[model samples]
Target: MGELMGRAVQRVSHEHREMAAERLRAAAGDGLISIDELDRRLGTAFLAVTFADLDAVTVDLPPAPLEVVAAAASRRVLRLAVSNGSVSRFGEWEVPGEIELQLEHATSTLDFRVSEVPATGVHINVQAFRSRVRLLVLPGTYVDLGSLGRHRSTVADRHGRAGSSRELHAVRLTGDIRGGSLRVLRRPYQLF
Candidate 1:
């Protein structure tokens, strides 16, 4: 076993690939790159194996803002791993700016009704298999369901599109969920 392989490459994780895809999507939405360019980069991103391979996709984009760099430095990220059965995040829990979820053969409930979600928005990178994901959102909360994915899944979005809102998105769903479903519900308005 002495045959030496080429220089070792630190393989990129699922979360990293999804994050890069999200960045490309955002860049396209912000008019930073053309749709054709976005399509080309997305293809490269999905097929990327190493960190350098993925990095090449977003290499030309401008770096993230200084404030975002600071926020990342402060470590506002959440990672959840669950297998089988159901999972829920509700009842005034701390909602961070970035979330990574790994679900296997499970049902997930993400209720944002009674939580103090970040105004800047939340970027969720999910890697699911044979699972159902339900998101409970309220009115006036911008939701972006248009993100990159490579899965055999279905999404039943009841919240519909954002109407006349200047905000980009209050919650942006990214990543892939294979052989399952994504259902979004708009919680009724409450004046309590």
Candidate 2:
């Protein structure tokens, strides 16, 4: 009876090992497991070949295709129009090539950076009071800021090269900025 019990335990252990191998193979094919990671996991399995050991292995499984889910979640577009107030403490805004912005009714401090803009156009119109607006533009891009008003405003093109592309992208900002601040950073691509 003792020998029989030992044999039964050995059989269960082998079954657990086989199950682990199968899971490892599936995970590898699914691109969830690198060969080195798989080897490490298998080594851990070999050290302890019981049901509880296998359960622990299953618990440590790497996430599956989470990038697609994350990208989908972070991708967004915003069109905001604020009126009859002062917008202060606006920070750097980066605009990617794929991003589209139509902003109007902004009143306050405005600081903006424009880089790597792949879009065909953008429209901005803003009004400010005792606020400073700054814009930085990249090379080979066009930006049209319609009617900007403020205590101080500066448009600087650091690319040092004349923009050869005559394709005018329009940004229209229309509002009143009274005693506040706004800053925007624009990138070549649309970012979340």
Which residue segments of model 2 deviate by more than 4 Å? 1-118, 149-192
Clashes of 1: 0
Tens-digit per-residue lDDT, 47-123, candidate 2 = 76455565566566654243332232224333333455444323445432222222233443333333222223334
Q: Which residue segments of model 1 deviate by more than 4 Å?
A: 1-74, 148-150, 163-169, 189-192
Name the top lDDT candidate.
Answer: 1
Count of backbone collisions within predicted model 2: 41
TM-score for candidate 2, residues paired by index: 0.27
lDDT tens per residue, model 1, 1-192: 222222225665554566677778778988999999999999999888887787789888876543443353225788887899787897667777778878999988888878766545677888989998888888667777777374788887765775432253368878998998888888763645
lDDT (CA) per prediction:
0.74, 0.45
* TM-scores, one per candidate: 0.57, 0.27
TM-score of 1: 0.57
Model 2, residue 91: C-alpha shift (Å): 12
